[model samples]
Target: MLEMKLTITAPDLSAAINNLAQTMSARVPGLQNGTSTCAEATNTTSVGADAVPAANPIQVTGVPTSAVPVAPAPTSVPVEQTAPVPTAAPAYTLEMIATAGTALIDAGKMKLLTDLIARYGISSITELDPSQYGAFATELRTLGAQI
Candidate 1:
């Protein structure tokens, strides 16, 4: 029986080990470069029996486990559009008619009276009708007195 023990000192033991592994791989049959078969065998024993040996072990530094990033949920908001309101037309009132009548009488336009009579069928103040004028006779009488 023969027994031998060899010891080597290097500035970078990892680099020396890697170089030795590369050299041993090139020299030996069925050995990958820059990796220890013993280390791979130890890892295989540590894992489940169902696990298979990796074809490329030199590229692996360690087991990789990372947390997957999750994106925030998208926010949604509803938008509303408003339209402008339309203005109403000015109303024709009895007070407005009286004011206009006073102005007409002050202007001394009796032709306005004849035109009104022809249009509304009211000849005089006392005989003034209201049906055609739509409740404007009282305001017209007040305007006639002013004249």
Candidate 2:
């Protein structure tokens, strides 16, 4: 009669167990489908009468009975891209318009300013809508006002 005992280290246990399962599956018919009556194991291992040698029954200690498959890493990672935000032009202020109007008046171009304002159906600068300030500013610029 002969006896043998093999001890596996903690780090090597996983690899050892995998190799053992492959060997057992090949040797034992019932272990091929990962099931047996001798002992229960998760995903890979199974034990039965034919799984163990008559002279030496293998024993595994301090190891998890389950085998978890690791997922493969992605071939290429996706990168998120963002478009640049459009910057809005500054809104024209009433004070800006007043400065331009005062400049035109001081330059003796009050008629030109008044005529420009009148073209927009407005008799006075105060009567002008805030939204029309941009167009008014552009006109005042053409009339030589430092708006």
Candidate 3:
């Protein structure tokens, strides 16, 4: 139910019609010329019906009553595609954990460090599971140690 209007004015009617028709024909492929008698005289252009519905008609102003049937420009609908994002591997390493633990102990947090390792059911860094290195490093950072 949307209405759009475009106006093209020229000194000569035949020149305007011919110009518009030629432009349309060059831009659109597989277009068919309408049954307008003036089309034969001025060599009217053809337009395709693809992406354009025949139900909604175009009205051209400032032209003879036998104005060639006008069709709106073809349009394309874009399809959205989503791609899976790759997750980076954890950067935790045993050396990194050991360094952070040593730093914490040197900074007078020996009791806190021992308590943290016990909470993970480990008596020492060597006894801590490899898979738990990331969590362990995170806890070490919370204790003012850089890892």
Segments of candidate 1 deviating more than 4 angstroms: 1-88, 123-147
Q: What is candidate 1's lDDT per residue for 16-99, written digit by digit as tens?
A: 555655665576655444443322211221234444554323332221123223788998786776785758533445455555
**Local lDDT at 26 for model 1:** 73
lDDT of 2 by residue, 13-50 (tens): 45666676666666554444452222222222224433
Positional deviation of residue 127's Cα in model 2 after best superposition, in angstroms: 0.9
Cα lDDT for residue 112, candidate 2: 95
Off by over 4 Å in 2: 1-86
lDDT of 3 by residue, 94-126 (tens): 888998989998999999999999999978899
Model 1: weakest 10-residue lDDT segment is 37-46
| Model 1 Cα RMSD, 1 decimal | 21.6
Model 3 RMSD in angstroms: 15.1
Backbone collisions counted per model: 0, 0, 0
**True-structure RMSD, every candidate:** 21.6, 15.6, 15.1
